[model samples]
Target: MLRRANAIAIFHAIRLQPGISQREIGDRTGIDKSTVSAVINQFDALGLLERVADESRKGRGRPSEGVRINGAAGLMLGIDIEPERLVVMSAGLDGVPLDVSEYPALPSESEFAGGVSAAVAAHLARGGSTLAEVRSIGVCLPGLVDRSGKLISSSNFRWGAVDVAGELRARFGQKVWVDNDARGAGLAERLFGCCLDVQDFVFIDSHSGVGGALYLEGAIYAGSLGIAGEIGHTKIVPHGRICQCGDGGCLSAYISGPALRDAFRGAGLVANSFAEMKALAEQNIPEAMGVLDEAGEILGLALSNFINLLNPPNIVIGGGLAVLAPYLMPPAERVLRRHALPEGLAHCTILISELSKEPHARGPLAVALQGLSQLNADGAFPW
Candidate 1:
């Protein structure tokens, strides 16, 4: 058990800081140098790690070798089912994407599992890869997913009580994992984005709708029902616009992509989509600016309430929200300064996500990596 724990620690250290020296791995993971060496040798023997020339070496008598996870070791599959599209991504254990493919989303909830299976097969065939090469499969759904991998409901798709994990497992005969899309994005931040070293933070995803995920003490807090971070549904107005979730005055109703576009259209703006609205805002159109300003203020009010309750050290704005950071952040920050508790506000820093392109796809990749790690810890890992 102790040895396994040490191996996990050393592996994570190497993963977090690829090309790290054995000594540095030991320092980061708190494992003894000898143990680190042994683990590195074992990993090398298993074809899990590769040694590279330490480029940072200066005035070295003998250049020390740096170790990193091998990109060719094996592949993990990530599937993201969104409202309009299904994205399938394949990555190595090192978290580098090998291939990504997009397809039209399934017509309805009944076709979700089979549709995903067909997409995965097509993606693998297109990439000249096979299921045998995949170590695990992770799925991201835009809805309420339980700890057991059951999707309880998704207001966007009107889906309910779907056994996402089981269905996928039956199709692929591989270990499968599932979670909410927003929470999956949080995992992606932890694995590959700005929050790599942050232990506590909030991730807000504003795309088709606004969603949130909470990461506390280095783990995602899914709450008792695995739906703890539905910040979008948090009531911000008493009886404002109706949200897709059938609730009035919800935060999503005010700032979601569709809502913003509709608001712009209602105000006599010529924007057709969220991207168009962003372009209009960039052009300094008065109508677009006014709509965004109002959305930003409302978002700020909700964020202020969130800060007061959680007091997280960081809040990462992602998805479509990141695109509007220039127009939205200033007003949001102003409201936060005026309304948030001083103590909490002082400690919190709001950051725009850096994963701009194919961000949602990365979430499921993190989920796959995390599921693989847990399986390894349990000694049930197949590859």
Candidate 2:
């Protein structure tokens, strides 16, 4: 177990800091020199890492060799299913994407699968690589996925009891893994986002509905049944509006995109989308500010409770809500100051996701890379 942990740490160190020396890896990861050297040799034997003479540092004390990830060692595939599009990304071992394909999303599962398969074929054809050369495939679903990779439910797609992993494996003829899109997004934050240096954090993703993912104890913490971090259902108001989850006064009923839109309509205003509502707020419309202020307070209260309970060092608000952090975070911070414990509130920092493009696509790509890490740890080299 210790060896596996060291291997994973050394691998991530090289991945995060390419062209670093073995000694620098030991310094960064705090692994002893001998262990770092042993693990580097093992990775070299597996063709996962490469060491070359450091020409730039020729005058260094011992002329340390530079260690870097071998991007050509293997390839991983990622499929992200969104409401409007199906995204397929082919990535090298170094987590850099080689190909990204976007297709119109379909209503039926089989149709979506067909679209993904065709896109995969086109991606492979352009790269001159076959399915046999792919390491593994990771699928990101917008719903609750059980430990067995069965998508138990998805309110967005109205999908339930779907064997997503099995179906994808059957179609692709490779090892496939499935995870909740929100959890995958949190993983992306840890591996490649602002939270790379943070260990314990909470990720709140707001879309048509609000969801969350928790990183605890240096890994993704899906509770016993893999249904933890449903922050949307944390009740903020007693006997408040009814939520689709059959709960009253839940955070989802107050701050979800649909909830915000409905709040606008309830105030005798018409806002077909959150962007429209944001524009109204910019106009200083009384009704719009009122709704937003109320929603922010409720969200803040819920976040305060989360902070009190988990005491995570950081909190990231993403998805559509991130765009409105300017309006929401202020009130939310006020609530945190008022309600959350002083120590916890003082220690935590809230930030927005800084994703460049295809955020959903990036999560599944990270998931694939994480799966590769686990595979390596288990003495199973997919390459």
Candidate 3:
């Protein structure tokens, strides 16, 4: 286990800085040279790292060598199941994607499951890799995922009590792990996003629906039943609008993609997607701007409550609506400052997610890599 920790640290450094030297890995990771060497040897045995000599160096001196993660060592498969689409990606240990595929999400449960399997197969074929080479598969669901990896409910996808992990494992004959999409994205943000510097943070994703996760001390607080970070359900407005969750004035009802589209429709603005809404707003459409501003303010008020309770140093907003941060964040910030405690509000920074463009795709890749790191010889991830 200690060797595993050392390998993870070294591998993480190599992932961050390709062509980094052994000495530099030790300097950056604070692992001693001997321990670094030992761990690197272990990784070499596992086919996870390789040393490449600097061929451009001057003739007389010994050639300097640098290390990089062996891209072909193993692959992680990331599958993100959305209401409208199923996105898949094959990524290396360094988080560099080799292939990606997308398919329309079918309403039939069996067909959707088959589509996911076929997508993975096609992605692997494009990359010339196989199921045998995949280290693990991470499935992202937009619902309440329990400790046993069962999705209890999902209004967007209309799923209930599905053994997601078990199904994937049975299909692929490989390790499978499952989690809420928001929480999976939060894990990615911690490892590869702005939260690297701030351990205590909240990641809110405003996709087709709204969801979020809380990270404290560099790990997610999954709560007792793994439903802790469902921030979108928190009531914001008193009896304003009906939410899909059978509640009134939930934050998701005001800030999600469906909500924004609903607001646009009510105002006589035709926007089928968030992109069109953004375009309308950029064209100086008053109704479009109003819709976004109102949503932002509602999000800020909801987040202010989160701040009062969690006191996180950073709050990252991602997913489709993140593109509207320019129009949305100022009003949201204003509301946050007005409602949140002075000390916490002063310290917190609200920023758009760096992984906003394809968070759903990158998130599951990150999760698969994490599960790969935690696996035992029997292909089980021990929490």
Candidate with top lDDT is: 1
Clashing pairs in 3: none
Cα TM-score per model: 0.88, 0.87, 0.88
User: Which candidate leads in TM-score?
Assistant: 1
lDDT against the true structure, each candidate:
0.82, 0.78, 0.78
Worst 10 residues of 1 by lDDT: 374-383
lDDT of 1 by residue, 269-344 (tens): 9765556778999998998899989888998999899899999999999877888888888889889999999999
By lDDT rank, best first, the candidates go 1, 3, 2
For residues 6-82, what per-residue lDDT tens digits would candidate 3 score against the true structure?
A: 65567777777777878888998788999888777766777777788744453748878888878778888889988
Candidates 2 and 3: which is better by lDDT? 3
* TM-score attained by model 2: 0.87
RMSD of 2: 3.4
Q: What C-alpha lDDT does candidate 1 achieve relative to the native structure?
A: 0.82
On lDDT, the stronger of 1 and 3 is 1
| All candidates in order of TM-score, best leading | 1, 3, 2
Q: Compose the digit string of candidate 2's lDDT tens values, residues 66-165.
A: 8888898888888888766778888888888888777777577646566677878877888888987787787787777775577787766765567777
Preferred candidate (TM-score higher): 1 or 2: 1
Error of 1 at 265 (Å): 2.0
Q: lDDT of candidate 2? A: 0.78
